[model samples]
Target: MKVLMIDDNELDLLISRKLISKQVTSLEFTEFTDASQALFYLQELQENEFDIILLDLNMPDMNGWDFLDEYQKLDAHKANVYILTSSLDTRDKLRSREYEVVKGYFDKPLKSNYIAEIINSQQVY
Candidate 1:
């Protein structure tokens, strides 16, 4: 499956990718440091191009909230989006509920098992 990861922090991005990779084989990962660029990338792609999108909440160019706002407006595929941020605040988790399409909120570093569940479940369905 294809996974699109959007995060400004290089280390966070690398760690996420590494963890995610361990869970699934043949994972097509597309990462972007800039959320705006990632948004544009999403706009350009066709529906069902990617199966999952792991987004970071705190970004310089465009925050995850703003990305979600703009993302809803664009004619894009309904990919399973998850908020993967470092923020441990419960408020951040609550705020994620505002987005209808968001699958779940996970505080990084994301575990291999968590990602494996998603990958395995998708295969089952």
Candidate 2:
């Protein structure tokens, strides 16, 4: 499976990669510390090039929400997006429901069970 992770924090990216790798053996990761850079990368890819997109809501320049706005305009394959955020606010979770491409919302420092679930969900597709 191919995964694109967009997060500003390097530590979080490393941790997420570790957690996800534990669940998926045949995994390919494309990580970005900048949301805009990720978006640009996505533009060049073909359909199904990425199987999943783990996005962080809190970012420096372009937040996850802004990324989603631009992502919606792209005439590219819309990979299933999972919001991996530290925000516990119900409002944020509720807001995520507005995005059709978003598949799930998970907390930071991703749990083992969540990684398993993500892997299983991807298999369904």
Candidate 3:
């Protein structure tokens, strides 16, 4: 599984990486602090380059909503995007459904059980 995690906070970014590493051992991991750079890479990369995208909702450079907006313009649509947010608002959850590529919405500090759930749900290997 090739996963790309985009978050602005350094602590959250590190914690996510650590949690993911503990849960999923055999996979490619890429971390992006800048949403625009991640979007650029996603657009330019080959089809199916990333299996999953764990995106943060509130970012300084570019918010997760904007990331999804730009992502829709790209041709690469294989990856399943899961919004990893700290926001508990119901509106955010409802709004995510508007995007075709978004597969799921998860709360921040993505748990090991959620990681397992993601693995089981995807079954992409």
Candidate 4:
């Protein structure tokens, strides 16, 4: 599976990659520290080029919410997006539900069980 992970923090991205890689051995990752650049990449992606998108809500230049706004303008693709954020606020979780493409909301320092859950849930689609 191909996963596009957008996070401003390099450590978080590295940790997520390691954890997720351990769970999904056949995974391919495209990491981005900048949300706008990631959005630009997504704009040019072909259909099903990526299976999932793990997005961080707090970012510099463009936040996850801004990215979603632009992402919605693009033609639909098969990528299921999950908000992998550090925010513990219920309001943020509730806001994520407003987006149709968002499949799940997860906390930072992503756990192995969450990766397993993502894998299992993805297979059902």
lDDT string for model 1 (55-102, tens) is 999998799999999888877667778888988788989888988778
Comparing 2 and 3 on TM-score, the stronger one: 2
Error of 4 at 125 (Å): 1.4
Candidate 4 residue-wise lDDT, 1-125, digit = tens:
88999999999999999988877899999999999998888777675488889999999889999998888888856488999998988999999999988999998779988899888988998
**Candidate 2, 1-125: lDDT as tens digits:** 88999999999999999877876778999999999999888877775588899999999999999999999888877888999999978899999999999999999889998888888888898
Q: Candidate 3, 23: how far from true, in Å?
A: 1.8
Q: 53 in model 2: Cα distance from truth in Å? A: 0.3
| Weakest 10 consecutive residues of candidate 1 by summed lDDT | 116-125
lDDT of the candidates, in the order given:
0.83, 0.91, 0.87, 0.89
Segments in model 1 whose C-alpha atoms lie over 4 Å from true places: 121-125
Residue 63: error of model 2 in Å? 0.2
- TM-scores of all predicted structures: 0.89, 0.95, 0.92, 0.95
- Which residue pairs come into collision in candidate 1? none
Model 3 spans > 4 angstroms off:
none
Q: lDDT score, residue 37, model 3?
A: 93
Candidate 1 Cα lDDT to native: 0.83
